[model samples]
Target: MKISNETKVGALAIVGITLLILGFNFLKGNKLFSKSLVIYGTYENIEGLTASNPVIINGFQVGTVGKIEPDPDMRRIQVTFNINEDIRIPNNSIAVIAPNPLNITKVEIKLGNASDYLKNKDTINTVASEGLLDDVMKKVDPVLYQVNKSLGTLDSLISNVNSVVDQKAKRNISDLLANLNQVTASMVQSAASLQSMLAAETGSIAKTMNNVSSITGNMASNNAKISHVISNLDSATGKLAELDLQKTLNTLEGTIKELQAMTAKMNSGNGSIGLLLNDPSLYRNLASTGNKLNLLLDDIRMNPKRYLSISVFGKKKTAEPLMLPQPDTLNAPYIIVDKKNN
Candidate 1:
């Protein structure tokens, strides 16, 4: 069959138009030559996210991103989107930015449970976040910039190091390695003597360990006797506890209280101790009497015959035996207390 050039051109034109329509329809996420719903959102920054990116919901691609523009305030990016119909979302839900198959940024709608579902034409909350690549690039951009600066500095440092090392060290480097080898060989020879000393100490360690085992065996054999003594001690302590401890304690406490009371009475001039403790006059009198008694004793010691004379009225007639004075009877009216005793 013979074909004209015009038919061939016309046929190719129809095929091209069909493919164009199909591509556009597919990009809009619809059947070839079919209609779709358009949704809108806003963003602060697109961060390399562009149109034709897949719009998704929790990772399910449901739509494609369309025309993106800056808002009137210029602080946010106003995004227009086309989504598949029959996909109702909640009003409380938000839209997130995701990436397409080519790692292209796109809008992904997230649906949270709400009181009422969103209609086909309903607008969603703007919660566009930077896509993974956008976030990664954001983090990497500064690091890359720092790395480039660091690489430049490192290059300068390396050049300096190369200038220093290449000049004279390269020539003597082999000599340094040779000297280090010689020192290592000498160290190995010295280590042999130290190894012999370590081997000699092993026998002493074994002997100490054997002595420790002997001591351990002795303690183990005496363990039962120690336990029996401790048990007997516990029984004796129990029996001791059963004694009239409370009565003894009470008696002790009573004695202590009485003693304290007596001491207090002494302080308040109420007992025999009171006379000695509280009366300064009594102390002074006792001191005076002691001095007088000391003087009388000294006189007697010097002239014993003067006080030992048995003659009456100082008329010494004969040296007779002396008799000691008797104590007064308690019932004899308490005897008009002798001045000396008082």
Candidate 2:
């Protein structure tokens, strides 16, 4: 057949337009030759979700995202994904949007086991997966709030400190800081001095320590002597313990009582010793007798011729005995005399 050029050009244009439409739809993730199920999901926000994003089932590519747009109310984002018709999805399955390690967005259908399968254009439950960044942001939000609150508190504290610290108080604090520094310096100097002193005395200290060690060694070597002393002490203690101390104390108490009784008797003037100590009549009588004896001895020495009347020739014996002078009556010394001479 003879073909018109206009017809040929029009037919080429139609073929090109059809091919362009098919290519556009294929890029939009519409399966032209394969069967698929269209499912819908709604979210408050979809991050990085676009058409042609793969819909995965257990990490296997099942289909692709068909479209993503705000709903008619513009209040929610509606995502439409096409799943493979061969892959049965239960009516109760959930669709989740997640990110890959490379931060690529993906749609995963969590398959369910309900006997009734999901039909085409059915709405599935949607959940946004908590990615690393999302979790980090969630955790960082509270921390940031706490940090802000802490900063506010710190500001308030600084204001309070400023209000409390006047010029005098600041001066006092400065003085205290200076004094503390001086004390620290003094302590450092003292520590250095002590270190030098210890260094200088190290040999003496070692010698003293050696002497102490030698003394301890000698004590250890003479342990038998120490034991002997301890044994002697123990034996003495045993002997002292065996002694009748109570009986001895009782005897001593009895002796003390007797002495006390004797003292009481003496004090009461009941004994001869007490009478000798307390009475004066016997002493006066002894003093008077001694005086009289002394007088008689003096009289006899002076008047011996009067006291001794003696005859030279033999006189005739008289019947009466010659009388001697009585010392108390005559108050003179007595002497033997011859009767004829008298």
Candidate 3:
């Protein structure tokens, strides 16, 4: 039993065609031999979605999209996707059209907490995830709007400035600039003057510096004398600090209090000295007594024989006592005689 060449060729062609079909279907995400569960979902829009896009569960590929068509109501799109039969899907699970890193759209199944699994051909909830570009636009929209608003504001500000800054303001600004330039030039001149004044040998500043150096040198030469003086001052201060100033002050205070008391007593005319100072009658009496004493002294000097006998020649003549005071004269001695005798 031998096959003909034509039959062999036909068989080979059939086999090749079969392999090619299988390969194309495999590349299109069709599982030829495995059992798969088909599920349905409806979306308002399925812009990047197409058949053969992978269906994922927790980032693992479970199946692929099967078909997409407008619903019977012609209002929304209905998507058919297949998942492995072994991978159970809760009835409340969601199918989201998500973009991968490559920007390829896929069906990402988010499992729900329902205990009941979804049966074949059951509709799952579908959501269209915002693409990267959509998200970027969403975020950038506000920024662009703010930028435009700011530009508008800036333009308004520029217009207002243009209106407010007239020729007079420009002239003022130019005058301010000129003044600033003059001030700058003055500062430069001052700086140059200061530099010249700080010359090493010829400037007044140099002379002052030399004087200061000389003074410092003199001070350095007399440093030992200064130290000695400082030491003496320190010693004096220490001794002064060691003195019993409080006790001295207390003693002085006591003396001052006593003096004050004495002064108060004198002022009050309470003591003998106070009485003598205050009584005019006593003063008058003392003056009278002094005058009488002076007359008695003059009488004694004028008549010494009356008071004492000089010789033993006869009985000493008894001298009469002065009873009146005589008027004082420049040529005669001043005397006071008793009035009765005068």
Which candidate leads in lDDT? 3
RMSD of 2: 22.7
For all predictions, the C-alpha RMSD in Å is: 12.8, 22.7, 15.6
Backbone clashes in model 3, listed as residue pairs: 323-337, 323-338, 323-339, 324-336, 324-337, 324-338, 325-336, 325-337
Model 3 ranges off by over 4 Å: 1-139, 154-202, 297-342
CA error at residue 137 for candidate 1, angstroms: 7.7
Candidate 2 stretches with Cα past 4 Å from truth are 100-103, 130-132, 139-342
TM-score of each: 0.49, 0.39, 0.44
Quick one: best TM-score, which candidate?
1
**Candidate 1 lDDT by residue in tens digits, 1-342:** 999999999999999999998898676565454456766777787667776777788778777777888968889887877776767777888887654446667666778888787665567787757556678899999999999999999999999988889646986997899999999999998899889998999999999999999999998999999899999999999999889999999999999999998888888997767998888667767766654555555555555677776655666544332222123322222122235744
Ranking by lDDT: 3, 2, 1
C-alpha lDDT values of all predictions:
0.75, 0.82, 0.85
Candidate 1 or 2, higher TM-score?
A: 1
lDDT of 3 at 219: 100
Q: Give the TM-score of candidate 1.
A: 0.49
Show the lowest summed lDDT stretch of 10 residues, model 1: 325-334
Model 3 lDDT tens row, 1-342: 999999999999999999999998799888889878999999987757989999999989999998899968878998998888899998888998887557778889999999999998888988888877788899999999999999999999999999999999999999999999999999999999897766754677677899999999999999999999999999999999999999999999999999999998888888788888887566566666766776677788778787676776777656577766555522454333343533
